[model samples]
Target: MFSLATWNVNSVRMRLEHLLRWLKLRAPNVVCLQETKATDQEFPYTEINEAGYYVVHAGGKGRNGVAILSDKEPREVTIGFPDVDDQEAKERIIAATIEGVRVLSIYIPNGGSVGSDYFLYKLEFIYRLREYLDSYFDPDQDLLALCGDFNVAPEKIDVYDPELLAGHICFHERERTAIKLLKEWGLVDTYRALHPDEKGAFTWWDYQFGAFKANRGMRLDHIWVSRKLAQKLKKAIIDREPRGWKKPSDHAPVIAYFEL
Candidate 1:
């Protein structure tokens, strides 16, 4: 079984110690990260490589960034959605082929509000993702894994209280629909597929207002797999322990195993 994981580390630099500790514990074959909040030169790739992984990143100044750290070398490493023309907006995507499986580490924009420009941008970004996947990948045949913070909860059960959070950024209709369309295109949420009846199985919580303590959270981070890869799925898990650690990221790591 090969193991892989995704995490939105908030800021890789600040959380490097925690991340290194976690890596030592889990030691997944491939790890994808989002919200690294560091430029390429500042990503601490040397430290990561010393930890037994080769790291690749697409990043800049003080915001969104994505990275891939793999025990095996990655080929065809790409930094952003090819079709999206905006080159300076934010670093949100990184992808490569590891052991024949296409691994995409993406940080989908967090829609600021229900009816805001940022919200529309988020939707368009997701749509662009769909377009990219359709153009380059065969979801039914290719062994593809999209692992990162998707920012949208694809189902009512994915949120603690869908009614209370109705039309909210991550729970909005359009956002959910975007994930719906992606799944329809032949990808499946690996966690949901395995734990169909599980509820309140969240991956993120607000650091404010004791949200994590109250168990008020949303399953924003995810590991989405193509049909062919899903068939090889062995296990999917959200490691919540990291969220309670010192200077945590407010998001947990989601790991999946497959008989690759």
Candidate 2:
């Protein structure tokens, strides 16, 4: 069984200690990180390299970065949306193939709210991603995994209060449609696929308002696998342990295992 995890660390530099500790505890074969909030020059490559993994990052100066760290050096690493390099500036995505599995770590833009410009951008981003995935790889043939902070809750059961968060940024209808589009494209939500009837399983909690204590959190982060890889699905989990730690990121790690 090989394990892979996705985490939105908020800021890799600020959360390095937590990350290192988590790595020691879990030691997943591959990890996809979002919101590193650092430039390539500023990314802690030395520490990560010394930690016994090769790292690849698409990092910006102050916000929105994604990276992949793996026990094996990846083949064919790409930054941003494929075939759209000129408009690729936000460092929201980094993809690579490790051990024949094509994986993508992505940080979807927070829509802010309904009808906001950021919301539109978020929708566009998802649409383009669907196109890119379809163009670049065959879900039926290629072993693919798309993981990271999606920033969108796929269903009401994914949130603490469906009625309360109905029209919110993360649970809005338009945002969900975009997520559904991905499902239509053949990516399975590993957690939901494994925990169909489960609830109160969340990956993110607001730092304020004692959200974690009340368990008023939402499942914003995810690990999505293509049909080809989902066949080997062994386990999927939302690791909330780190969330209870000191100075933790608002987000927790989402992990999945596959028998290959």
Candidate 3:
């Protein structure tokens, strides 16, 4: 049995204390972190190394970053989408092979507004992501997991208030379409696969208006498993209690356990 977790730390430097506490409790075999918001020079490599894990990270100045931490050192690590053009190659994706499983950590663009340039970039990013995965498709691989903060709610059930959020960047139709395309490519959403009818389970709570207290949240963080490993999935959960912690990130971790 192996357990994997994904969390958008918001800022690794600022939340190091919180993360350390959580890691001590959960001790997941593999962890994929998003929104690290720190450069390579700024990451606390020594601290992480002391925690008994190998770290593979891709980060920028302050906005987007992704990383993977593994209990067993990965045989290989790759940062960024493989086939992306130069423009989209900025830090957003990281992958590593741990225990024979290919793990990917990604932080999708937030796409602030409907018609904004960032919004277009978000859609284009998904397109490039699909293309990159197409080239790397390997059905023979028995364990492949992609986990991250996709910055998207693929269905109305994913958000607390879908009507009010319709056409919003994260809940927009275009983004949903892209996500659906990825599903068609044979990746199963492990959480939904376990709890097909579950609801009101969310990973991200907006900072404004005391959203977490009111339970007004969205399931933006996710774990996707290739069909081969999806069958062995044991359980999946969103750790909502972390959001209640003092000075917590807007997002919490999503965990998936499997019998690999």
Candidate 3: residue 234 lDDT (0-100): 95
Alpha carbon lDDT of each predicted model: 0.92, 0.91, 0.87
Candidate that beats the other on TM-score, 1 or 3, i.e. the better one: 1
Q: Any runs in candidate 1 off by more than 4 Å, and if so which?
A: 88-90
How does residue 217 of candidate 1 score in lDDT? Answer: 95
Tens-digit per-residue lDDT, 90-204, candidate 3: 5788888898889999888999988899888888888887787778875446578989999999889999999999998799999999888877778999999988877888899
Global lDDT of model 1: 0.92
Would you estimate the TM-scores of all the predictions? Answer: 0.98, 0.98, 0.96
Error of 3 at 72 (Å): 0.7
Against the true structure, whose lDDT is highest?
1
TM-score between candidate 3 and the true structure: 0.96
Where does candidate 3 stray beyond 4 Å?
A: 139-142
Each candidate's clash count: 0, 0, 0
